[model samples]
Target chain A: MRAVIMHGPGDVRVEDVDKPTLVEATDAIIRVTSTCVCGSDLWPYRGAQKSRGPARMGHEYVGVVEQVGDAVREVAVGDLVVGSFVASDNTCEICQAGFQSRCKHQVMMGSVGTQAEFARIPLADGTLVKVPGEPTPAQMRSLLAASDVLGTGWFAAVAAEAGPGKTVAVVGDGAVGLLAILAAQRLGADRIIAMSRHADRQALARRFGATDIVEERGAEGVARVKELTDGYGAHSTVEAVGTQESMMQAIRSTRPGGHVGFVGVSHGVELDGRDLFNATVSLLGGPAPVRRFLPELIDLIMADEIDPGAVFDLELPLEEAAEGYRAMDERRATKVLLSV
Target chain B: MRAVIMHGPGDVRVEDVDKPTLVEATDAIIRVTSTCVCGSDLWPYRGAQKSRGPARMGHEYVGVVEQVGDAVREVAVGDLVVGSFVASDNTCEICQAGFQSRCKHQVMMGSVGTQAEFARIPLADGTLVKVPGEPTPAQMRSLLAASDVLGTGWFAAVAAEAGPGKTVAVVGDGAVGLLAILAAQRLGADRIIAMSRHADRQALARRFGATDIVEERGAEGVARVKELTDGYGAHSTVEAVGTQESMMQAIRSTRPGGHVGFVGVSHGVELDGRDLFNATVSLLGGPAPVRRFLPELIDLIMADEIDPGAVFDLELPLEEAAEGYRAMDERRATKVLLSV
Candidate 1:
C-alpha cells in the first residue's frame, strides 16, 4: 500500500508501506477513498513542527470499510464512512458534551495515518458516520471535507456563537476560515467579515456570503474590524490562524462580551493576560470536536445544501501525494484533495 | 468631607477633602454609609501597581442618595442604593447585554472617589440598585457586600456556568472567592472546591457551602483539585485572584469544555497561548459587570437567603479608614468595611 510519509522539512514522499489491519475488537479496516491535506499538516511539512524520524501523515479521510472486528456496530464492511481526525467513543461523558476532541478515549488518527491505501479505525461504532451509500463523484469532495475542515469550520462557528444578529469576523484565509464564512452565513449571522489579503481567498470568502472583506493583518486588521463594527468590534470572531498576531487580532476584533472560537493549531502564541482579561470576551477553542457535527454536515453535503468541498482547488492521484503537500505548502492551492 | 487617599505605597490616610456635588445631568450625590477596601486597592498600596500623586481610593459602597441631578431617575434623594465600582448609562447596547462595566458611557467610580463622605455617582439610575428600604445594621453588611464582592462572585459563578450537577472550584479564598462558593451553591452545583491555605478563610468557605477544601497553592493546588474531580478537573472554576499562578490554576482546574470565570483584577498574569489552546477551557472574566447582577443579588440578600458580608471580618470608622486599608494590606483581615 502506498502511504504518505515525512522524512524532514519540505520533504514528503509516497512509498510502499504495510497496509493497516484490524488490531482491536472495536476496529474496522477501511480502504481510503479520499483524503486531503490540512492547514495543520503544513506545520511539520514546513519544519515549524519538528518531525522525529519518518512519521505517518494526514488524518482526514472518507473511506469504505473493507473489514470489521467482532465488536464493531453501526458500521460494517462495504459501508462508506466519514470519521473525525480524532477518533472518539461518542458515548463518553465528554463526547456527550460535544467535545469529542477531548474524549476520554480519543485517539489522534494522524498517528495511525489516514493518507494511505488502508487504515484501521478504532471505536468504529462511535467514530464513523456511515453515509447512505457510496457518494457520487460530485459529492466526494464534500464528504471528505466532512471528515475534518467543514466540521471544524462548523465547530468554530458554533463555538463563536455566530448566528442571527451576530457580526462574525474570520481571521485566517485558509480553507477552514473560508468554510467558517460559509458556516457563519449558514448560521444566519447578520454580518460576515473575512480578513484576507489574497485575491483568490477573498473571492471565495465573498462567494461564501462574506458581507465585508478587510485586506489587512495584525493591528490594522483589528482596527478595520472595529471600524466596520461601529468601533465595538465584531460580535463573534473565528481565529483560524494560531500565530500570536492572529490570536490577538481575533481577541481585539471581538467586542466586550463577544465570543472568539479559535481552532487554529496554536504555535508560539502567548496571549497577554491584561489584554484577555480586559477584553472580557469568551475564548473557546482547541482541536475541534468535529465528530459531533459530522452527521449534520454529512446531511448538508448529501442534500447539496452546502458545497464546502469548493475549498479543494487542487486534486491529485494518491501516488502523487507529494504534489498535494507541495501545492498547499507553496500556498498555490487553497486545499488539495487526493483520490486513493 | 473626609476621604481615604493613597499618598504612596504602604501609605493610606483619611484627610479632609472637598465634598462632591452633582456635576452632570445624570449624576446623583450619595452620602456614603458603608464602603470597603478591595483586594485590588492593595495592589497600589503594596507597590505592585504604581501610585502617581495622592489618589482617591475605594470603589465599593452602599449609601443613601443625598442629592440628585436634574436627569436622575430610578434613584432619588434618600433612596437606599448599592452601586458597583463602575457607573454606566445602562441604556447602551453593552449594558443591555449585561456587561455594564464595558458600557459606552462607563465611569469607574474609583475615579469619582467612592471612599469619600459624599460621592458623586454618574449615571446614577443605571449604576445604583435601589434596596427595598433602609437596611438594618445586619442587612447593611450584606447590602454593602452586594455593592461589589458579592456581585463579583455571583458574576464569576454565572460566567463559569456553575449550575445544577456541575462541579465548581474556586481559586481564591478572599471575600470574592468565598462568596463564589455561596453563589455556586445557590446556582445548584453539586460540588464546590475551595482552594485556600488559611484556616479562617477555608472555614468561611466551608460555611459558605464549599463541599471540599484544598489547602494547597500553585501546581499542588491544581493537582489536588484534579484528584478531587476524578482526575478530570471541575466543570467550572472561579478565579478570584489575578496573579498568573491563580489564572493558570483556574484554567487547568477546569476540565476541557468547562468554564473559568475570573473576576480578579488581572495583574501581571500572562496566559500562555499554547497551554490555553491545548486545555480547551472556555475563559470568561473581567472587572465583573457587577451591575448586571445587583438587582438579583440585592433580592437574595434582602430575603436572608444568603449572607456574603460575613467575609468582612473587620469594620472601622470612616475617620480611621487608614486602618481598614492596613488590616487588609497586612492580611489581618479577609475584608474591611468602613462606616462613613
Candidate 2:
C-alpha cells in the first residue's frame, strides 16, 4: 500500500508501506475511495507542529469496508462508509452524552493514515456510518466531507445555538467556516454573516446563504458586526480560526449573553480571563465530535439538500498526493481531494 | 446622610454626606435599611484596583423607597425593595435576553453609594423588586442577600445548568459560593460538592446543602472531584472565584460537555486559549444580571424556602462600617451586614 508521509517541514512524499490489517477485534479494513488534506495537517506541513518521525498523514476519508473483525456488527464487507478523524466506541459514557471525540476507547484515524490505499478503522461499529448505496460522483464528494469538515461545521453551529431568529457570524473562510454558514442557514438562522476578504470565497459564501459579509478583522471587524446588529453584535458567532485575533473577534462579535462556538484547533493562543468575564458571552468549542453528526450530514448529502463538497476546488489522483498538500498549504485551494 | 468613603487604598472612613435625591425622571431615592461589604470591595481596599479619590463604596443594599421621580412607575414610595449592584432598565433587548448587567441603561449602584443612608437608584421602574411587605429581621437579611450574593449564586447555578440527577461542584467558599450550594440544591441537584479548606466555611457549606467538601485547590481539587464523580468529573461546576487557578479548577473539574458558570470578579487572571479549547467545557460567566432573578429570588425568600443570609456571620451598626470592612478583609467573617 502507498501512503503520503511527511519527512520534514514543507516535505511530503508518497511512499510504499506495509498494508494495514485488523489488529483489534473491533477493527475494520477500509479501502480508501477518497481522502483530503486538512487545515490541521498544515500545522506540521508549515512547521507550526513538529513532525514525529515521518508522521502518517490524513484523517478524513470515504471508504469501502473490505474486511471486519469478529466484534464488528453494524458494518460488513463491501459497505460504503464515512468515518470521523477519530474512531470511538459509541457505547462509552462520553459517546452516549454526544461527545464521541472524548470517548474512553478512541483511536486517532490519523495514525492509520487514511490517505493510503488501505486503513484500519478501530471501533468500526461505532466509527463508520454506512451510506445507503454506491454514491454518485457528487455524492461521493459530499460523503467525503461528512468524514470531518461538514460534520465539524454542523457541530460548531449547534454548539453556538444558531437557530431560528439568530444572527450568526462565522470568523473564517475555510471549508469548515463556509460549511458553517450552510449549517446555520439550515438551522433557520435569520441572518448569516461570513467574514471573508477573498472575492471567490465571499461569492460562494453569498451563494450558500450568507446575508452579509464583513471584510475587516479583529476589533474593527467586531465593530462592523455590532453596527450591522444595531450595536448588539451577532446572536451567535462561530470561531473557525484558532488564532488569538480570530478568537477575540468571535467573542467580541457576539452580544452579551450570546454564544461563541469555536471549532478551530488552537495553536498556543492565550485568552484574557478578565475580557472573557467582562464580555458576558458563553464559550463552547473544542475538537468537534464529528461522529455525532455523520448520520445527519450523510442524509442531507444523499438528499442533495447541501453541496458541501464545493469546497474542494482542486482534486488529484492518489499518486499525486504531494500536489494536493502543496495546493492547500499555499492557499491555492480551500480543500484538495485525492481520488484513490 | 452618612456614607463609607475610601480616601485611598486601605483607608475607609464613615463621613457625613448630602442625602441623595431623584436625579432623573426615572430615578428613585431610597433610605437604605441595610447594606454590606462585598468580596469585590477588597480589590480596591487591597490596592488591586485603583481608587478615584474619596470614592463612595458599597453596591449591595436592601432599602425602603423614600421618594420616586415622575416616571418611576413600578416602585412606589414606602415600598421595601431589593435591587441588584447595577440598576438596569429591564425593558432593553439585552435585559429582555436575561443579561440586565449589560443593559443599555445600566448604572452601577456602587457609583451611587448604596452604603449611604440615602441612595439614588436609576431606572427605578426596572431595577427595584418590591418585597411582599415589611417582614422580620431574618427575612430582611434574606432579602438583602438577594440584592447581590444570593442572586449571583443563583445565576451561577443556573448558568452551570445544575438540575435533577446532576452533581455540582462549587469552586469558592465565600458568601456567594456558599449561596451557590443552596442555589444548586434548590435547582434539584442530586449532589453538591463545595471546595473549601476553612472549617467555618466548610461547616456552613454543608449546612447550606453541600453534600461533600474537598479541601484542595487547583489540579488536585479537580482530581478529587473526578474521584468523587466516578472518574468523569462533576456534571456542573460553579466558579465563584475569578482567579486563574479557580477558573481552571472549575473547568477541569467538569466532564467533557459539562458547564462552568463563573461569577467572581476577575482580578488579573489570564486564561490560556489552548487549555480552554482543549478542555471542551462550556464556560459561562459575568457580572451576573441579578435583576433578572430578583423577582423569583424574592419569592423564594418570602416563602421561607431558603435562607441565604446565614452567610453573614457578623453584624454591626451603620456607624461601624469601617469595622465591618476590616472583619471581612481580615477573613474573620464570611460576610458582614451593616444595619442602618
Candidate 3:
C-alpha cells in the first residue's frame, strides 16, 4: 500500500507501507477511495509546527469497508462509508452532547493515515456512517468532504449561532472557511462576510453564499466588519484561522452578546483575559465534533443539496502525494484531492 | 452630601462632597440607603490594580429616588428602586439582547459613586428597577444585593447553562460565587460543587445549596471535582475570581461541551489559546448585565424567596466607610454594607 508520510519540514512523500489490519474487536479495514490534503497539514510541512517523527498523514476519507472485526456491527465488507477524523464511541456523555471529538475513548484517525490503499478504523460501529448507496463520482468527492471539512464547517456555523437575522463574519479563506460560508448560508444567516485577500478563494466564498468580502486582516479586518454591521460588529463570527491575530479579530468582530466559533487548530495564540472579558462574547470551538453532523452532511451531499467538493481545486493520484502537500503549502491549491 | 473616596491604595475616606444633580435628560438622582464593599474593591485597595486618580468608591446600591430630569419617566421622586452598577438605555440592540451592561451608551455607576448620600443615575429608565413596595431592613439589604452581586451571580449561572440534571461547579467563594450556588440551585442543577478553603465561606456555600465542597485549589481542586463527577468534570462552572488560576480552574473543572460563566473583574489573567481549545468548553463571561435580571430578582427578594444579603456579614455607618474597606481588605468580612 502507498501512504503519505512526512519525513521533515517541507518534505512529504508517498512510499510503500504495510496495509492496515484490524487491531481491535471493533475495528474495520477501509480501502480508501478518496482523501485530501488539509490546511492543518501545511502547519507542520511549513515548520510552523514541530514534527515528532516521520508521521502518517491524512485523517479524512471516504472508503469501502474491506474487512470488519467481529464486534463491528454497523459497517461491513463492501459497504461504502464515511468517518470523522477522530474515532469516537458516539455513546459517551460528551459524544451524546455533540462533542464527539472529545469522546472518552477517542482516537485520532490521522495516526492510521487515511491517505493510503487501506486504513483501519477503530470503534467502527460508532465512528463510521454507512453511505446509503453507491455514490456518483461528484457525490463521492462530496462524501469525502463530509468526513471532515464540511462537517467541521457545519459545526463552526452551529457553534457561532449563525442563523436567521445574523450577520456572520468568517476569518479564514481556506477550504474550511469557504465551506463555513455555505453552512452559514444554509443555516439562514442574513449576511455572510468573507475576510479574504485572495481573488480565487474570495470568488469561491461568494459562490458558497458570502454576501460581502473584506480584503483586510487583523484590526483593520475587524474594523471593516464593524463598519458593515452599523458599528455593532457581526452577530456571529467563525474563526477558521487559529493564529493570535485571527482569534482576536473573531472575538472583536462580534457584538457584545454575539458568538465566536473558532474551528482552527490553535498554534501559538495566547488571549489576554481582560480582552476576552471586556469583549463579552460567547466562544465555543476546538476540534469540531464532525461525527455529530456526518449523517446529515452525507445526506445533503448525496441529495445534491450541497457541493462542498468544489473546494478541491487540484486532484492527483496517491503516488503524487508530495505534490499535493507542496501545492497546498505553497497556496497553489485550496484543497488537493487524492485518488486512493 | 457625603461620599466614599479612595485617596490612594489602602486609603479610603468619607468626606463632604457636592450632592449630584441631574445632568442628562434621562438622569435621576437617588438618595442612597445602602451600599456595600465588593471583592473587586479590594483590587484597587490592595494595589493589584493601578490607581486612576482619587476615585469615587462604590457602584452597588438600593435607594429612594430623589429627583428626575424631564425625560426620566420610569421612576418618580420618593420611589424606592434598585439600579445596576452600569447605566444603560436598555433600548439598544445589545441591551435588548439581555446584555445591558455592554450597551452602546453604558455608563459605569462606579464613577458616579453610589456610596454617597445622593448620586446621579444616567439612563434612569433603563438602569433603575423600582421595588414593588416598601421593604423591611432585611428586604432592603437583599434588594441592594440584587443591584449587583446577586444579579451578577444569576447571570453567571445562566451563562454556564445551569439547569435541571446539570452538575455545577463554582470557583471562588466570594459573594458572587456563593450567590451563584444559590442561583444554580434555583435553576435546578442536579448537584453543586463549591470550591473554597475558608470554613466560614464553605458553611455559607452549603447553606446556599452546595451539594459538595472541594477545599483544594488549582489542579488539585480540578482533580477533586473530576473525582466527584466520576472523572468527567462538571457540566457547568461559574468563575467568580478573575485570576489566572481561577479562570483555568473553572475551565478545567467543566467537561467538554460544558459551559464556564465568569463574572469577576479581570485583573492580570492571560489564557493560553491551546489550553482553551483543547479544553473544548464553552466560555462566556464579562461584567454582568445585571439590569437584565433586576426585575425578577426584585420580585424574589420582595417575596422573601431568597436571602442573598446574608453575604454582608459586616455592617458600618457612613462615617465608618474606611473601616468597611479595611474589614474586607483584611479578610475579616466577606462583604460589608454601608448605611449611607
TM-score of each: 0.98, 0.99, 0.99
The regions of model 1 sitting more than 4 angstroms off are none
**On a 0 to 100 scale, what is the lDDT of residue A37 in model 2?**
91
What TM-score would you report for chain A in candidate 1?
0.99
Docking class of 2: high
Candidate 3 stretches with Cα past 4 Å from truth are none
Q: For residues B1-340, could you state the per-residue lDDT of candidate 2 as single tens digits?
A: 8999988888889999988877799999999999999999988888888888899999999999999999989889999999999999999889999999999888988898888798899999999999996577998999999999999999999999999999999999999999999999999999999999999999999988999999999889999999999888998999998887898899999998889999998877788877887788899999999999999999988888889989999999888988888898899999999999
Scored by DockQ, the top model is 3
Question: Which candidate has the top score in TM-score?
Answer: 3
**Candidate 1 local lDDT, A1-340, one digit each (tens):** 9999989988889999998888989999999999988899999888898786698888999999999999997898999999999999998878888999998898999998998899889989889989985567868899998898888888899999999999999999899999999999999999999999999999999999899999988889999999998888999999998898889999999999999999999999988788888899999999999999999988888898999899999999988888899999899998999999
In model 1, state the lDDT of residue A41. Answer: 90
* TM-score of candidate 1 relative to the true fold: 0.98
Worst 10-residue stretch by lDDT in candidate 1 chain A? A132-141
lDDT tens per residue, model 1, B1-340: 8999899998899999998888998999999999989999989999999787799999999889999989887987889899999999998878988999999899998898778788999999899889996566878999898888998999999999999989999999999999999999999999999999899998999999999999888889899998998788899999999999899889989898999999998888877778988898899999899999998888888888898889889998988888888889879999999998
The 10 consecutive residues of candidate 1 chain B with the worst lDDT sum are B130-139
Separate DockQ for every predicted complex: 0.82, 0.84, 0.91
- TM-score of the second chain of model 1 compared to its true counterpart: 0.98
| lDDT string, candidate 3, B1-340, tens digits | 9999998999999998998888989999999999988888899999999987788889999889989999988899999999999999999999999999999999999888888888999999999999987798899889988988999999999999999999999999999999999999999999999999999999999998999999999999999999999899999999999999999899999999999999988878999899989999999999999999999988888899999988999999988999999998888999999998
